[model samples]
Target: MSENEEGTPERTDVRKEEEDSPRDRTRLSDICADVKISEVMSEETTVVRESESIEDIIELMTRTPYHSFPVLNENDELLGVIGQDNILELLFFERSHRHHHTHLMAIKALSEDASTLMVHHPVTISPDSTLCDAADLMIKHHIDRLYVIREKKLAGVVSRADIIKKIHGLRRQ
Candidate 1:
């Protein structure tokens, strides 16, 4: 459809065929395997303290674009993740939406601090891990993002959007 640098007409049909070939798929997978998590993750991540009150966390949710935040202890160790689902319990006072009333939801509703309210043992990946590893973990856990942990501390964060963007960029090149 267009002329290349050599002043010859480029065969777009053949190029399209090549893109859909198994070799190209293998190349893409190789790129994913080679790319590290630290290269694609956001280092300047927003986090919350475990001791922070529910009011403070609510305020933070209102101010930030993030739907979830990694909860940290005084020593900066990652404790858990506090997401919108955890905060939604506060909206209902006496009644729960589930068919069977859950005692855990009621406890979450009564929780005062981030530590008690947060979801424990959040899915995490190491910064040293590959982008493919991150993708696999996210798919297995059905999560949109993963907290990058190092030495039990929050190192960074990688999101599904980040991986998609990286793949798109590579394709363009």
Candidate 2:
């Protein structure tokens, strides 16, 4: 309301500007802040042994729908994850066999193991970490997934897809 000729004070909605701000809609924190990661984590994780031959590992990776697999040592220690980023080299190496390439990767001939291909010391999240924390980690590291660790072992895995599914479920309910 505008001031009247009698010098009355005007009234305006203080929340209007904030409600229309673009930043409010884009920040993942607002949606994920209150949720716990464990609630949305995938417990049926596919973990591979670090000493497994690369061919075996590749077969396991292809057999599963998951884009990444946690690599563990003989003692079941969390070694790292064999993520999509790690598989690109294999794709190129395989590509080399069907046709000539500008560059030849020495990896094609080596009988390497998961220890050689898995990303070492991958970033891990605590089982109790909030979904927002997981989102921040994923964004900061440019990763699509995070392994939830408990007692230095793989408790589960959480992916961006899982987070999205959780959000969708929440919206539906």
Candidate 3:
């Protein structure tokens, strides 16, 4: 593993394969079904606090390569998720596209904390869930990452890159 441009650890040894190859697809499917989310998840997840200011979130985003962060309350319970897209939209509110853009824009202008900026009810998966289940949820929700929730708390996180690396590992083996 090597650090990427952003200083995030990256698996440089993972080889890319043809996504449409029938044999590879079959093998990937089998592997996904067998592997648990906990096996490939990022155990020490960087998270944001609901009370954190937008400046704090921006600072974190600049220092870390993560595109999103799980927002937690004082009790360490999952509240929601705040992503780069959320910040971007707020920053460029003039080009808003959502039906409730005005409403959101007003809220953003008044609130500087994560609790108001986060997307509630984010898609999540259990630590015991199979990689297959995580993958399915990601595809269904068009998301790049899923927060692993266990006992109503954040357990870890599973990203699309993690699953890809797992598949690559199996292919090489």
Candidate 4:
């Protein structure tokens, strides 16, 4: 017998079966294939304002193991980056000076201000960028993290740790 005008019985059954089935299980190759930065990025990222004091920044770093932070302006625009190394250098400089006490006091004073020593114009990336692109940028710049931007706004962060995690996960399979 001829099928109905709407849809043939066999076709309808096939459509229903396809809809009932779950999405195809991805292979390890598919998971690792051209992985995008957004796929592995950490959505929960710590940020610091440009006006924040160095002392406060140091305190925040102590609370977490974050090696770097993206500095933002009052409008939430990325201004630069400040890494733990920079803070350590400042501390070392204060300690080595002949006028140790004066230098210590000066360091303390400088820590209260943000713009005095913060790195300006940090490297940034778009959320849609591939993981390979982010990794390349990190290697080229010798940076540990890349700020993910979406529509000119901070979206998330892609760090070396995140990339390592992806590699670890892939290795398990």
Candidate 5:
């Protein structure tokens, strides 16, 4: 007898055939169903004002996991972003041994205005835009996140991780 009969009836090497039918491609609506920018966004976003002190900004960075934040003006208008890199640059310049302490102090005094250090005119995306659009914008600009706007106000923020999670979820299906 063959191995199949000798053993407990070795399973047949039969493969189920897929029906000869065309599968419906997923549409944007389907991909976005029940998913909103507000749903996926990190709602508890850290924000700093243009007038915030560098010390305060540094403290915020130390306390939060975010590397960047949306800066707001006194009127709550979007100013730009302040990131960890910006703070690092300032600290490094201030502590450089090549510069005299007096000179470093002078520079620090003039750098008190956070607006001067904040990035101006950061790219932003609307909250209603498709995730694909957001992903494309990030890819084109080589950025990690996009500030989500709604009614010309900061509504939420979308990051690369959010997009990756959505893609991974679809793959599992």
Candidate 6:
């Protein structure tokens, strides 16, 4: 039994299974070591269509509070990706190229579609990939999220937040 500040008895018998084993205590790092991408990936992905207007994409970004999204083709196959940085770069390019009023620059960029703005060939991962691999990929590529693909089609999305959530859930601290 464990006691809090009030000195009330608290159950600390979570070690039941491991009680008889040599490793009675659990470490968060050990628990999170075996976690795979499929275990933490978000299946409900919000992707953008290749034909959607850049304005629509931007609105989707602001409205949904999403920083990035995968761009798909007519067949729903993964095409590319568009992130906040990508959109901002395009907008900046428009402003520089046009050298016009802000409103006119926005209107000009709005006419552009996903195909023109998407960052082609985004980094992807497999469902079987370990969390360590995913993290390594993100660090190596300087990305915040990864698209989980199967059979050349998008299956889910895994992000830094997801990894953090999984580790937090271990509760071994």
Segments in model 4 whose C-alpha atoms lie over 4 Å from true places = 1-33, 95-111, 170-173
Candidate 1 local distance difference test against the native: 0.85
In candidate 1, what residue range of length 10 has the lowest lDDT sum? 92-101
**Model 2 residue pairs with clashes:** none
Q: After superposition, how far is residue 135 of candidate 5 from its true place, in Å?
A: 0.9
Off by over 4 Å in 5: 1-38, 94-109
lDDT of 3 by residue, 32-132 (tens): 89999999898899999999999999999999988999999988789999999888888777666666477757787568899998889888888999989
TM accuracy, model 6: 0.71
lDDT scores of the candidates, listed in order = 0.85, 0.75, 0.85, 0.73, 0.72, 0.79
Q: What ranking emerges by lDDT with the best candidate at the front?
A: 1, 3, 6, 2, 4, 5
Q: Which pairs clash in model 5?
A: none
- Expressed as tens digits, the lDDT of each residue in 1-173 for candidate 6 is 77878998764555543354334224544555588889989999899998999879888988887889999988778999988986886677645654554674455455588876787878889988888788778878787889999888898999999987886566534
Error of 5 at 71 (Å): 0.4
C-alpha TM-score for every candidate: 0.81, 0.69, 0.80, 0.66, 0.68, 0.71
* Residue 117's lDDT in candidate 2: 73
- Superposed by TM-score, candidate 6 places the C-alpha of residue 35 at a distance from the truth, in angstroms, of 1.8
Model 2 lDDT tens row, 1-173: 67868887654443443455423444546667778888989999889998888778778867888777899987777998787656776656655555534333454335378877776767788888899898788888797888888888788889999988996666544
Tell me, what's the RMSD of every candidate? 6.2, 10.6, 7.5, 14.7, 9.0, 7.0
- What does the lDDT read for residue 170 in candidate 1? 77
lDDT measured at residue 38 in model 1 versus the true structure, 0 to 100: 90
- Candidate 3: segments with Cα more than 4 A from true spot: 1-24, 94-100
- Between which residue pairs do clashes occur in model 4? none
Query: Candidate 2 regions off by >4 Å?
Result: 1-31, 90-111
